[model samples]
Target: MNKLSVKVKNLVIGGNSPIVVQTMCNTHTQDIEASIAQCKDMVAAGTQMIRLTTQGLDEVNALRVIKEQLHAAGIHIPLVADVHFNSDVAIAAAKVADKVRINPGNFAQVHKDAAVQFKKFLEICKENNTAVRIGLNHGSLGEEIVNKYGNTPLGMKEAVMQWLSMCKENDFYNVVVSLKASNTVVMTEAYRLLHNAMQEDGMLFPLHLGVTEAGNGDQGRIKSAVGIGALLKDGIGDTIRVSLTENPVNEIPAGHTIANFFESGENEILLDSVMAQIRRGSSKPEAIISVNSALCGNTDTRSQDAWNEFIIKASCLFGPLLLDKQIDDFDAVPNFSHAHNHDHECEHTNEHSSDHESNDAEEQIFVEMKKIFSADRLVEFKENLMQAARRKFTHPEYIACPGCGRTQYNLEQTFNEVKRRTAHMKGLKIAVMGCIVNGPGEMADADYGYVGQGGHKVTIYKGKTPVLKSVPEDQAINALIKIISES
Candidate 1:
């Protein structure tokens, strides 16, 4: 497939260019000063493209001022207007933003009406030379497509193809495409299907890669790496975003690590050594023990760089294996004498020493490993890897959007509270979303949703039905828990 390069301002995506790393602002777009400040910080953090939520004409107009100020300050990075459920705003934004992202599913309730709106949107974008990102996410596939294709990867591919066909019919080529999902398996499969279909059709659009609503911290990074890394390794991604439920600035480096891991051979060498050892089967435990010891031994997990490298390498190594079902789980010591007998207190030895005296070589290594990577942390890693791969759910699955300008409440704080309160609930898919426009639909298959509805209010939903409408912010979590408890 010959891929066309998309030009958003001076930055280019696809067509032999390096993978573009991008992020979106979490500040309210209407707050011109805050949005501009955030944009400058994003640029300083190495963001190639920054997207701001333009939920209406007001936000769109604010975006215009934001872009002008950014350019005036010589921050020439492209600004993308994120518009949903409002085609008129998108059309107006086409004149202002360097790029516009629209979810076709929410562009209109009716598919035909969406097509009509999108055609008009394309005309304006073409007139202004603005780029468009046909962003379609899983769990948000329109009813018509879901009924026919069952909300699967095929449905995601089919839905996007219709819009791509429309773009071709309208002769608009300045476009990129994305198919994101919080589930790594679903996300990877959707992109693969779309890539193959586009290859067969001979009109491939540049792909924007992301694992949407992946919660923050190590789990989020691992999940994004597993989904994005798999496709990137297969030569399928163009631009990438690591969506974390944290400060948007943090996404830049996380994204760079994933992109650079592929460019550099360091991670591949690490993975190959482990794979070879696993394949030998002669001393699998010895191989894993040695690798873990080398990687984590004498390593301070406190340093951001060290932690990032360790997690990224671990994700690259174990995430793909788990996702493909090649391995069920990972254990650093499977053949040790103390495998099932070791106590967390290290009762038989000094707890502070990595150089504890032990007759068994495996025991010595195991003790050292437990010191560096605690037993609890190792277990946590395994569980995180399993959940990220969609193989198991030892903890509550959180689908949280990296809050945007459209966000009304304190999303990160609210999501953390939600996780803290619901920590005991296992195997449940819960979503803590930021706003109503994309919240309900993007939460996808989450069994429960806590969606923010501006003015310091929230609506708790049980699988798309609002159980508590306009609940006060302070009482929202309690209400959500109450509903869940009742259910």
Candidate 2:
């Protein structure tokens, strides 16, 4: 990934810079005493940056006081002014704040003369050497983006792109960007989309990541992990603020924990939000899926009880569960377990009770992922998530287990070889397995199977029936591709 270095006061972001953990103060900004105390606490808690809300003119002076007090106390972390609509306040904040965070959607709405306002805003930021973050959110994307792409990830990306384009026009390079959503899936997918687009355009401004309106407690922490963790694993983020609906101080630890976990090569670890909204308002899901989120204990030299605890937590979440298939904001990679039972339960294999809703959901996932991962796993997702699988898969459907000791051959290498050759072919179900006993049975819905027969040999199946027995491992890749193309 291409990295860009951006200066916010004394802190530099991107391009070999350490991922900075940030927190925002929940206290009213005009309350200088409370703001100062919180800022001190945040700085003490290892916060790299502190964000304070600047809602009006009064808060502008408040920012100055907070900065002065923090500086007096010898804390020099960059202060970011979180401004929504008031560019007047934003301009005042730039004079005092190290960085000014503006919501482009609301900023656009408030300033009808966007060109003039942005030009002035950029001039002030440049004059002061104050950085800016052009943050966009799903709920606040304004007329231009909503008109073009609706309230979706693409809209969020285009919204930021429009602002970034304006920043370029004004010769403003001290800018960061964020596209935040409460749903981890939506948030992660949005970052991936924007990253690709920016990389293609050679734009590598540091990115600020967060899950907006993520509610309190364990759910908040797990969600913060899933959304931000996904991108960090992909090496896409520069700074992060885990927006827990709790004390801002709690957010620091959560954000830093996520950073440290991803940094230590725990990339594949997933936290299960279980795709539930906690039955918001009066609305209720027909059934309840109870999943207590867990993380592998954070230490070296822990007992196997730690590993046992990990399995126990995971098993309880997915145990004896059937796919009620509650799709979250996006097609998140986290696998969850949920049992199905309720008054409104209906059985229809191919269709949900609500076709329009399902179509909307499926279409949204398809359009979003098409931008982010089509070259990676978009093919498999199209087959599984969208209904296109019923018509004909546009990509190969692959299944492989993390092999065990009973396995006869090297499943990982063989699976890779098979996939490498036939990844271009569509509408084929291929299975690669470690052991022969459960392997063939597990290939239940697959169109073809490649199970280990013995050392360096593979059994190729046409549907459920074995068509070729004990083919050489070297010949298996060609054999699988040949069968798919021929069939």
Candidate 3:
């Protein structure tokens, strides 16, 4: 079987090459500046390639302008034009862009001369020395394949193979294949099956990886990471894109971060940076307010009512700040308390004195907050927090096993603590395993890990590379932390 290996400009896409991370621009192609600005920004943030929609003549004209501007700026990164329902646009884009991405699912269904249209499109790409991405989306699978195989992994793989065969038949070999399904399991399974089938058939076609309609930032990123990350870990994917509903700018970073994980094995550092930014931004108080109102009820009920009133007043003060900053779920506030530990002092203090002190304390707290968080700084802080919250899977990830009777000291507890402490740290995976029996294998890919042994001894491994043979249980966390922090 031929190994799947293909090159895009200077970057290789398969056969032991590091997976390429890519994204598409959502900006209107006619708005050249906006689209180019976004493309440049994504490129700067480490996106390996950019894809843009070239739907009609207007978009094709825009592509030419955008390509000229990018070339002038010395950005020679590959640009792919996504074409659907139109082969002419594909031909036009092939003239300018470095690559053309076509959905065979739709293109093959176009007309009786669909194959001829595709052949013409391939000829244009070949003349331009442009690569072609045979993007096969599950949502648009060919009717015959779907009917034959019920839209399962087998069906998806068949669809891809059919298109790949067509490409070969037309003597178009500068091709990459992508089989995408919104369902993660289906996506993963389909790719695995396709990889095996291609290998068996002795086909050497590079694969494009993605989960289409991956929803919003948070959920979409997580799903993409898991699906694509798993495949990359297994040496399956050649190029990858994380589809999201959010801004295209956001997609670039997420793609780069994932690529960075495999390229440098530095996911922990990325994860930590994201977490720290989240913690810092999350710690800020949304509001501080002074409220004075008489309550008519039993002491407990009156206290509850006063607390509710205080919360309402505080939310009113902070609501605008939250909205202006685009912070979600800002209405939820952290708990506050002013209780003193010394009961004796509280008893000795006069009731009137206590009331006066409480009022004074509230005033002081409000004043202190105002002093620390000026409006400008607060806005900046919120901006930083939002950036942190933005989904970018550039962190060290772990797949630690839960401890069992093969066991050691509180594996779950240690795992939680390590995760908490390293939450703000990125690109580091620390596995806390129950025993050495299966621990080493489970944590083989982990950057740093501790596998428990009976009676206080544990084995530590780093980056699927074994380190110290054994260490005491009590010292494992510190040792792991030190190694991760240093790394």
- In terms of lDDT, the best-performing candidate is 1
Q: Model 1, range 1-487, lDDT digits (tens) per residue?
A: 6789999999999998999999999998999999999889888888899999898899988998888888899788899999866888899999999999999777745445777888999999999999999999997788888999998999999999998999999999999999999889999999999999999999889999999999998888889988888888778899999999999999998898888777676556656656765687733322133223333335443346555555665676667777877677666333434443323423423432344334444456555544444446566776787789888888999999999887889999999999999999998999999988789988988999999999999999999888888999999999999999999
The weakest ten consecutive residues by lDDT in model 3 span 293-302
Clashing residue pairs in candidate 2, if any? none
How large an RMSD does model 3 have? 22.8
Candidate 2 Cα misplacement greater than 4 A, ranges:
268-487
Give one digit per residue, the lDDT tens place, for model 3 in 280-365.
Answer: 88545434332231221122312433333333233222322332343353312223343322223223224323453674553443
lDDT of 3 at 347: 34
C-alpha root-mean-square deviation, each candidate? 5.3, 24.7, 22.8
TM-score of candidate 2 on Cα atoms, chains taken together: 0.58
lDDT of 2 by residue, 345-432 (tens): 2222123323325645433322222222223232233233222112223556565533432356765566667667776766666777
Best by TM-score: 1
TM-score of predicted structure 3: 0.55
Sorted on lDDT, best first, the list reads: 1, 2, 3
Give the winner by TM-score: 1 or 2: 1
